[model samples]
Target: MGERRSTSQSLVSWTRLRPYAMISPAILVFCLFFIYPIGYMVYLSFHDWNFVSPTKEFIGTANFTYLLSNLEFREVIVNSFIYTFFTVFLTIGISLLLALWLNRGGAIYSFLQASIFSPHITSLVSVSMLWMWIMDADYGLLNWALNLIGIESIPWLTSPDYALTSLIMVAVWKGIGFNTLVFIAGLQSIPKDLYEAAELDHTPPWRRFLRITVPMLSPTLFFLTIIGIINSFQVFETINLMTEGGPINSTNTFVYYIYQYGFQFFKIGYASAAGVILLVILSVLTVIYFKVLSKKVHYR
Candidate 1:
């Protein structure tokens, strides 16, 4: 009888632990890939180390101080914010308009929607390469088209004045299709009865949209806003491929700045500090976004 009791107790214990055992691999992966890297990055931020160095020198906050006081780093921060602002604003605004116009059912609308979204599905590297050719100062499609309209060739990526603006344009163009599709989905989810009820009161088109449509889309708008801010702040591929953060660092952003310091300049500690700053900024922005917009989002 004692032996039977022991076996039953052991079985119960194993059953209790089985779920945890099943999930252990996923937990291990999360720790290895996510938590470990972040912790190591934080550790590296406080020490000076070349990529090939045998040992890291403890520098405390010197790396951060250098970054904060550096004029180039300050400019990179400004460029990042400016790029994020324009990219998010234009992408959301234009996509919202497109979503409204294309929300109806039709073959033509379907084709147009597919066409718009095609750029988004294509790889970013390929898109960057294609845009490079299009925006080339000489013998580029954009300049060619402008010259046809009796306008002089404007340096799209070569001029400091236009380089950042050109990057913003590419980001907006790439993002609009995805945003529009998401907006369309949100619009469709909103019940038709809401509009019908508003129309019964002889409401103007704009008033109906403002009262019914806008409120219903608040959740979608909030979602897209947060995502746009995060993605825009991380813009790197286009800057790297198209401009290489050139035209006097007009297009230099946080990620590219970190890449330069870490990889090109081999300043691992400095790059880690920039990475830490980016992480902190993103975290603060996300928290603020949730706090401000949580009450505004109208669910179902």
Candidate 2:
């Protein structure tokens, strides 16, 4: 009886430990890859080190102070905010429109959906290169088209006035398909019976949409808004491949600024400090997002 009781106790203990044992590998991997890198970056942010340096020199918050005082970094911050604002809102707005139009089941709708989403699945390198050709001021497709209509060629990626706008356009085009697909899913999940009831009361189309559709899609909107902000803030490939933050740093954003410092300039500590700033900005945005937007998200 004593042996049987001991065996039962061991079985209960094993059952209790099973879940943690199953999840231990994932937790370990997360710590190694995610937590460790972030911690190291934080540590590096406080010291001065070029990539080729044999040893790091303690610099305290000089990196952060320089970034704060630097005019170029301020412009980079402005550019990031501008790019993020335009990209996120345009992607969400246009995609919501497209989702509404294409939500029905039909072969033509399916084909159109696939066509729109094709750009999203394409590599960013390819997209950047293709857009470079298209937006080239001389002998480019955009210029050619404009010339045919008697409009002079406008420098899309070259002029400071239009360079950031051009990047925002690329971001929106690439992101819209995914946002639209998600919105469509959200729309489908909403109860059709509610719509039927509204229709029975002879509700206006606009009223039905405002009263039913918008509330039902609140959750999707909130999700896409947060994701869009984060992705737009981290934009790098398009700027790197297309503009290289050129035309006098007109297109220089946060991620590219960090890259320019870390890899191109070999200012590892400076870049790390910039990275920490980015992390803090994102964390604050996320917290504000939850605080301000959570109440508005309808979860039904």
lDDT of 1 by residue, 47-140 (tens): 9999998999999999999999999999999999999999999999999999999999999999999999999999999999998999988989
Backbone clashes for every candidate come to 0, 0
TM-scores for all candidates: the values are 0.95, 0.97
Candidate closest to the true structure, highest TM-score: 2
lDDT (10s digit) by residue, model 2, range 102-199 = 99999999999988889999999999999999999896898899999999999999999999888888899899889989998999999989999999
What lDDT does each candidate get? Answer: 0.94, 0.94
Decoy 1 TM-score against native: 0.95
- The lowest-lDDT stretch of 10 consecutive residues in candidate 2 is 134-143
For each of the candidates, the C-alpha root-mean-square deviation to the true structure, in angstroms, is 1.6, 1.2
lDDT of 1 at 144: 97
Candidate 1 Cα deviation (angstroms), residue 85:
0.8
